[model samples]
Structure formats: C-alpha cells, structure tokens
Target: MNKLLKTISVSVLGAAMLSPVLSTVVFAATAASEQQATRNLVQQLSNIKSFSANFEQTTKATAGTKPAQRTGLSAQHMNQTFVGEMKVERPGKFYWETKTPAKQTIVTSGKTVWIYDPDLQQAVRQTLDDQVANTPALLLSGNTAQIMQAYRVAQPDQSKTYYRLYPRVKDSAFQSLTISFGTNKAPNMMVLLDSLGQTTSIRFNNVKVNPSIPASVFNFTPPKGTDIINQ
Candidate 1:
C-alpha cells in the first residue's frame, strides 16, 4: 500500500511525482504559435510565488483483459479517487497531504524531500534536486527554455484555457500531459497519460495563488517510532 501511495504521488507530479506536469515534448514547425502560447503560459505560472488548492485525484489503470468481453469488473482496471490538499512555493518547495482513501504527506523543502505514510509508520527522505530533477513539477522553479527543451506545447482546442504538452524525449514516464487554467489564469486541472495509456487526472478547487505560507509547512520530522529511510 505504501508503494501504491508512492506511485500515486509520483503520478500527480504530472510527468514527475504527481501535480506538476509540464516537460520537454518538442513539436514540429507547424505548432510554432501554439508552442509560443505554452511558453507564455509557463511565464505566467512562473510569476506565482505561492499556491494552495484542494484537489481530487483519480487514477485509472489499464484493464488486464477487455472489459467488453469480461463478465465481471477487473480489479486491474479499477479506478480510484483520493481527496487531498496541495501547497506550492517557488524555488522547489511543495506540500501534499491526502485526507481520504488514506492519510499521507509528501513534502519537499528547498533541500530535502520527504514522503511520509502514517499508516505504514515510515517515511522516505531524499535530496530535493534528485527527486524532482526531471519531473514536470520542477517547472515551477525552472525557466522557459527548460520547459521548451523537454516538451512541445500546444492548445488543441479553441479555448485558450487548455494546453497540451507532449514529451520530446521518447523515454518519458508519461505519454502526454494536459493542463487547464481557470478564468484567473491559474491551473485548475491537470491530466497525465502514462506510457501504458493509464490516465491520472487531478482537479484543483478553491485555488489561492501567491498567498503567504508558513515556513514550517515545508519541514517534516518523523514521529516517534516511525521508521525513516534515507534514499
């Protein structure tokens, strides 16, 4: 279950460990304008120093067999939703805590990243740069060239609110990513398609941008008796 939760968290970073999803997917010349628009969007998001939001995360796995031919629902292809809260600050700080389906917290200060699972009584620690090195979430603190180098951006629809990002690297964790912005020009939703075609979708509500956040929120200390693993 801890492993599953870890995967869930990673999936949310979009192409990284689950809510941050935008990376290198280079496009053809025909998509020049759309690509430019994507850069513009990134520039806007980069200006935000802090962000908080309520999120509903749904993970849809692939079926082992064709459901159409199967008599019963396949657990392999089951869909699950988890409710959570997300907080982000510039220069590589983030916090995510799940309140339902299980209780877990993933926090990254500027220096270290911690993934804590209360039910398992364990926490994993690693350097922040290594954990988020190639993830889409790194875009929050990265430059436009970094984003453009990894992904090709395009707006598939007439609605400027939606943007599609495809990985230029063939070996990316997810196949593609799509992020939707609300009227306030803040990201309200993000969906990632993994290599296996499974989709991880997250919806953000009650989003507050550039709000002040306490420094302690990014720090974590394993509780008494909790096992700590350094990665």
Candidate 2:
C-alpha cells in the first residue's frame, strides 16, 4: 500500500468504525470543564448501538513542509470527493463500501479487520485493535476519563454538537480531528487531518441511528482467487 492508502486504512476505516472497535486510555490534558464536555459528548456517542449512513468523502493533500507553502498547496487539491456507505455496531462490528472514485469494502468483526479492493484483486487483514488505537475519538469504547488522557478536546464553536480533538500520543497517525453530531446524537461528519497535511472529511447523509444491523455483514470470505495479505 502507498502512503495515502495506508493512512486511509487507519483514519477513514477507524473513524467510520468508532462506535465499535475502540478501546483507549487517555489523560486529562485540557481544562476540567472541557474534559467534562468531551465526556458528555462521548457518552452520547456510546449510547448508539448501531448506525447506518450514506456518505460523501473528500480528501485534500497539501504539499510542501512549511506552513505557508502547505497553505498554498491545499487550495489546488481541495475538491476531490468519494461517495460511500457505512454501517457500524458497537463492541466490534463495522461494514463500509466505497462506490465512487474506487470500489472497496472494509469489514471488521471486533477481532479482525478486512480491507478488500476488487480492482486490485487483493484482501488485506489486520487485527482490529491496532487499527482503532491510532484513530482519533476512538475513545468511545473506553472510559470517559481515558478520553481526557488521550486528547485535548475543544468545542471551538461552543456547540454541544461539534468538537475538535488533538491527540496526545506522538505515534498517532492523524494530527487532529473534528466531529459533528446530528440532532439524533449520532455522528454526522468527521474531518481528519493527518501528519502529511492531508485532510479527509466525511459527511453522512440519510443516517439511521440505533438500527438493526446483522452480524453477518461484518464477516468476509475472500473470493477463490483473491490474494490475502495478512498483516
């Protein structure tokens, strides 16, 4: 996998599966009140047992290393979009299918994650634990206290529905994340900014919260001729 795809497999899939495969431990890095607010937000998210949505994802890659140069490069690649659909269930189950720009499916059964690309005729498998660990806001499955330990949460707009998170872990893949919740208290969109200065924003449409999602959707059997790459 190239740098972009590798980053996507972690952030995109991880954010999309936040209600499931997340188990984190964070510290209190922000104000006590802010911590409490983040906890409240996470608590609301944790209450969702299942969800489904049609999505539109846009990724922008910024060039150059210096901040000024990156700012200029960001404008040139800010409009690329990919459309998809996703379903997630708590305690380790998720299914995501990207239909435009590329065709792919990613599924996880809490224990393992599978990434399949039909065009490439390849299926890659990795432990679900590792993938979720590096994904921001994945603290929903963990205790609220842990969320404070891992991220510095800020509600820049002071709206109960929007939050921006900065990861405390040095090895984390993304630099920061912003999440917005729908009136139903389920995630409506997530924006992830990675170390490479690439930003991926996913917006959800036709969202269904606490819907019935079957266990079968999280399991995948590679086709007879597909190459299986175990990680």
Candidate 3:
C-alpha cells in the first residue's frame, strides 16, 4: 500500500498524510508570475465543487533487503474531500476506496475502517493516526496554507512549481515529500520519500475541474454476510 501511494501521487496530491505529500502535475510557469499564478490556482481550487482524475503511481527503493518498489493506477474523485478506487496491483486486485468529510470515514469499509472478507470474515480496524500516513485524505481536505506549514515550497522552473516538505514530528515515518504543479496551473502530482529512502511518485490526468459526481461514491454500505470488525 505504501508503494501504491507513490504511484497515485503522480496524479493526485489530495491525499493527506501526517507529514503531508501532494501536488498538481507540472504546468509551465515563469519566475515573474509564480506567486500570483499559484495564488490564482489555489483560489480556483477552493471554489471547485467537484473533480475527477486518473492517476499513475510509481515507487522505487534501493535493491537488497530494502523493499523493492513498484507502481499502479488510482481513479479518483475530489469533492469537498477525496474518494477513489485504486488497485495497488494488476487486474484491479487490491482496491482501496476513500470517502471524506468525516476524515473518519475516508477509508471505511463499514462502520469499521477495514472491510470484512466473507471468505476470511475477519477484518481488523486500525486507525492510521499519523496524518502523514494518510496523505490522500489530507491532500483532498487541506488548502495551500496548511500544506506550507510543514513544507518548504519551491518553484523549481519557469514551468514547474515544486514543494519539498518534511514531517513536523521528529519521529514521523516519512523522510520527505515533493509535489509538482502543472505548467497550466493545476495541483496534479506528488512524490513521497520514506526514512528508508524509498520514493513514490504519482501523476493525475483527464481531470474534471468542477463537475458533479454521485453522492453514493462517498457512502459505505457493508456487503451481505460479512462480519463487522472493530478494533
């Protein structure tokens, strides 16, 4: 799942983890126009009623005992918050859905956060408390100012705005985060780096700036004959 994040971030920074990781895909920008353009983009984002995008996520790490990283796709919706279906592996095997507002319900499968598998019928619910770990949630829930608190905001090139951020807590799980905005001025891509020096990168495409989506997408109803796990 950690590796999956790196891939999805290529498209959506709407994920909010504790230390913070997010960004829009690269858009051309000029040094003279950086601050204003960014401000305009933020303002535009704040006014958006809905959004939909596709993400390509990728991850990498040093070879050896360290975990070998890979990537995948995350189809997403950014309303007041973020909700999406993503497969961490192929054939859409591992799918994670996000629902927001409650922050509590963002990753829920039922009243419980983890879904019960009828085959196993056993699911354990664990609160991934460290917001840094819930990058997707924060990315969709927060604004630019909130993100700036922990990251050193940088505009790397005339066409690219980047953010280099780290966790505020010394013991936070991640080492750093990088977010990139598109030259056209959209918050579209992000990259996360963990303490192990592993990196995950995500990109967004086919975006809908402000469109309508089904409310049911954010609601969770447990499957039939499944045990509700609360832990």
**Higher-lDDT candidate of 1 and 3:** 1
lDDT of 3 at 188: 70
Question: Over the stretch 7-85, how does candidate 1's per-residue lDDT look in tens digits?
Answer: 2222222221333455555433332376566766676676677888998877665556354533222344247677888
- Candidate 2: clashing pairs of residues: 26-146, 26-149, 26-150, 27-148, 27-149, 27-150
Candidate 1 local accuracy as lDDT?
A: 0.66
Single out the weakest 10-residue window by summed lDDT for candidate 3.
86-95
1 or 3, which is superior by TM-score? 1
Alpha carbon lDDT of each predicted model: 0.66, 0.66, 0.43
Arrange candidates by TM-score, highest first: which order? 1, 2, 3
Candidate 2, residue 75: CA error in Å?
A: 14
Evaluated against the true structure, the overall lDDT of model 3 is: 0.43
| RMSD of candidate 2 to true structure, Å | 11.0
lDDT of 2 at 25: 43
